[model samples]
Target chain A: MSVELDIILSFKDKMFRLAHRITGSYEDAKDIVQESLIRLWKMADKIDKYANPEALAITITKNLSLDWIKSKNNRINKMQIEEYENVLVSKEFSPEKSIEINQLHEMILKLIDSLPAQQKIIFQLRDIEGLTNKEIAEILKVNENIVKINLSRARKKIRELLTKIYNYYEN
Target chain B: MKIEELIEKYFEAETTPEEENILKEYFTSANYDKKLEIYRQYFIFLNSERNIVPGNFLPASILNENSKSKTSFNILSYKWLAIAASFLIIFIIAFTYFKSNVNNAAIVITNENFNEFKDLGTEVTFDAFFKISEYMEYVKSSINDIQAVNETFQILQTYNLMNYQ
Candidate 1:
C-alpha cells in the first residue's frame, strides 16, 4: 500500500476509537469518523499542510462529534446516555466486581463532562488519546501553555471529585 | 523539589512532560501516599482508557461505493460539466428575460401616445390627475397658513416691545 493508504488504514481505528469515546455512541462515532475520513480525503492534496496526521484526524473527529452532540441534543434519549455511561464504566469493572468501581467511573465521567469544553477536549486529547501537549496544542490551534493549563484544570477537577466520592464512601 | 511543590507545580501546569511522567510514576509506585490514592486511580483510569474503532465493513462500504460511481461515469469530470450546463441554462433564461424587459421599456419610451392609446377611460384619467393636483394644493395652502400665523405672532411681539419702551 502507498504511504497515504497505509496511514489511513493504521489511523482509522485510533481515530474512530477517539471519536467513539468523545461522542459516547457507536452511531455518532461512526458518523464522525466517516466525516473525518471524507475531510482527510478531500484535503489529500494538501496532506503536507498538517504537521501530524493523527492529530489532525483527532481534531476533525472531535469537532464532528461536538457538532453531532449539538444537533442531536433533543434526540438523545435517557437509555442511550445510560448505555454510553455503561460502556465507560464497564471497562474497569465487571458486574461481579464491587459496584464502587462502577460508581467511581460514573462519577469521574460526570466530573470530566462538567469541565469547560476546552478543558474537556484537552483532557481527552492528552490523557485519553495519549497525545503530547505539543501535539494537542497544534491540533487545537492554541498555545502550548493553554493546553497545559486546561489539562491541569481538568486533572484538578477530577482529583477533587474523586476525593469527595472517597469521603462519602468512607462515611 | 518537595512532593508538595511538585504537586502544586502539576496543578499549575508548570511541570514538563518528563516531570508529568515522574508524577504518574510516583502515583503508581509503592511510595504512593494514602491520601493520594484517589489521584492514582484517576491517573490509571486516564492511562488505561482505550480507543475502540468500528469494524472494517463501514469504510469498505464507502470505498466500494466510491469505486462503483467512478466506473459508471466515463469521465470523472462529467459532474462539473453537468453543473456548468445547469448554470448555462440559467444564464440563458436570465439573459432572455432581461433583454425582453429592456425591449419592453424601450417600446414604452418610444411610443409617445402609448398612454393615450391605452384603454383607460377619460373619466379615470380626469379623476386621477385632478385628485392628485387637489391634494398638492391642499398641502401648499396648509403651509402658507402656518407661515401667516408666525408672521402675526412676530408683529404682536413687536407691538408689545413698543408699548414697553
Candidate 2:
C-alpha cells in the first residue's frame, strides 16, 4: 500500500474514535470522520509534507466535530424542547453484576454528557482518547496550560459526581 | 497517602502520570477498604469506559462508502460544456452590443453633421434675403439698371407670390 493509504488506515480508527468522543453521538461522529477523510483525500498531495499525519487528522476531526456539535445543538434546540427531560429521570438500579455494569456505563455516559462543551471535549481527548496534553493542545490549537486546566477541571467534576453517586449507592 | 491528600493533589494539578497510575492501581485493587469500594467501582468504570469504542459501526460504514465515492469531476453532467457555452454566448452578445453601439454612434454623429450643414444652408439663404432687403432699401433707384436683378428678385419672391395668388 502507498504511504497515503497506510497513513489513512493508521489514523482512521483514531480519528473516528476521537470524533465519536467529541460528538457524543455515533452518527455525527461517523459523519465527522467521513468529512475529515474527504478533506485529507482532497489534500493528498500535501500529506507527505506534514510531519504528523495523525495531528493533521486530529485537528481536522476536532474542528469538524465542533462545527457538527454547534449545528446539531441548534437543530436539537429548535426541534426538541424536552431534550434533557429523559436524561434527568433516574433509572432503577439492579443487583446483578452485568446489570450494574450496564447501569454504571449509562451513568458515566450521562455524567460525561452533562459536562460543559469545552470540558467534555478536553476530557474526551485527554482521558478517553488517551491523547497527551501536548497533543490535545496542538489539536485544539490552544496553549498546553489551557489543555491542562480544562482536563483538570473535567476530571475533578467527573470525580465529584461519581463520588456522590457512589455514596448514594453505598448508603 | 491519605485519600484526602490524594484527592487534593489530583485537584491541585500536582499529580504526575506515575501518581495517577498509582491512584488507578489503588482504586482497582480488590483488597482496598470497604469504604473505598465505591471509589474503586468508579475508577473501574472510568477505566472500562476509556476503551469502550461505543459499539458504533456507522463510522466504518461511512468511511467505506466514502472510499467508493469518486473524487474526480463527472463529465456526463455536461456542466463544464454548459458553463463554457454560457460564457461564450455572454462574450459574443457583449461584443456585438458594444460594436453596434459604436457603429450607431458614428452614424448618428454623421447624421447630426449633415443636419447642421443643412441648417447652415438655411442660414445662408436667410442672409441672402437680408442682403437683398438692404440692397432694395439702399439701392432702390439703381435696382432696375442691374441686369437680371428683377428676375433674381422674382425667383427669390416666388414663394411669396404663390401664397398671395
Candidate 3:
C-alpha cells in the first residue's frame, strides 16, 4: 500500500539475487538482503521522491554484498575447495547425467567468478539479476555504455568457457 | 531480422537489452539450430541460474525480523557503529588540526591528550576510554582514515570489567 512497501516488494527478490550471486551463500545473501531492507525501511517516508528507488536498493545491496564477500573471503575459499573436492569425489559415485549437470553448475559459477570485476558485476546485474542497463549503470555508478560493454565481454568469455566444457563433456 | 543477424549484433554489443533477451530465449529453445550447440547449454544454464531465487524469502519476513527484537545487542553492537563513532571523533580531531596546522599533512594525537582525560575517574572514565581508543588505532587506522592521524593511543575494552563468579 505504501510507497516503501511498493519499492521493497518490487526489488527485494532482485536484491536477494544480487547478494546471493555475489556472496555465493544463501544465508549470507539473506542477511545482506535483510540489512539492505532495514536501510530502505528507514527511508520509507522519503522513498518515493527518489528518481529510481530500485537503483538505490540495488546499490545498497551491492555494497553490502561486497562487504559480506570481503569479510568471508577465507570461508568462501574453504567452501570452494570443498565444493571442488565434492565434484571430484562424486565423479565416480554419482550417475553420469547428474554429475555432469552438477559439475556444469559449479563450473558456471566459477566462470562467472573468473570474469573481470566490472564484467562480472555487469553480467550479474544485467543477465542474472535482470536489471535494465540504465538501472545497472545507476547501481554501478557507471555509464550505460560501460554497462553494455562489460556485459558483452562477460558473455563472450562465458560462452568461451562453456564451449570448452561442452566440448569436454561431449567428447 | 534473422536469428543470425541478432546473434551477430549481440556479439558486437549492438543490440538493445530487450533484443539480447530474445537471443537468450532463442538459444535456449529446442528449435535453435544445432550448430549453436556449443552455446545452447550455456544459455540454458544462464537462464536457469538467473531465475534461481532462494525460496520462502519474503519481504514481510525481513520487516518482521526487524520489528521482533529491540534487544540491546541487535544493532548497536555492529562494528560499524563503533567505527563510525570513532570516525566522527577523528574527523573532529582532523578539523581542529587543520585549523591549527595549515602546513602539515597529519595531526598527531600524542600521549598528552590522554592525560587531559586521565583525571576524570568514573565507570566511563578516561582509562576505559584510553584502552578502548587504543584498540582503534592499530588495525582501525585504515578504517579511521580521513586525513587525521596520531602516533599515540592504546587499549580497547578489556575483560576485567566482566569478571564474575
**Which candidate number maximizes DockQ?**
1
Question: Where does the lowest 10-residue lDDT sum fall in candidate 3 chain B?
Answer: B149-158
**What value does the TM-score of chain B take for model 1?**
0.32
lDDT of 1 at A56: 77
Write candidate 1's Cα lDDT for A1-171 as tens digits: 335545655677777766665666777788788778877766666776667778777778878877776777623322333344454445644455444654566667756655666786888776766678888888889999899878888878766666555664455
* lDDT tens readout by residue for model 3, B9-89: 776667887897888889877789987765666667778876776665555654564455444355657767888999999
**Which lDDT tens digits does candidate 2 get at residues A17-104?**
7777667777787778878877886676689898877889888988898788787773331322123333323444444323265665
- Candidate 3 lDDT at B113 equals 69
10 residues in a row with least lDDT, candidate 1 chain B: B103-112
Ranking by lDDT: 3, 1, 2
- Residue A114: error of model 3 in Å? 3.0
Arranged by DockQ with the best first, the candidates are 1, 3, 2
Q: Per-residue lDDT for B65 in model 3? A: 48
lDDT of 1 at B117: 47
Q: Which stretches of candidate 2 lie over 4 Å from their true place?
A: A74-90, A94-99, B1-7, B26-33, B54-165
Clashes of 2: 0
- Candidate 2 chain B: minimum summed lDDT over ten consecutive residues — where? B54-63
Q: Per-prediction DockQ scores?
A: 0.25, 0.12, 0.21
> Chain A TM-score per candidate?
0.75, 0.83, 0.79
Error of 3 at A151 (Å): 1.8
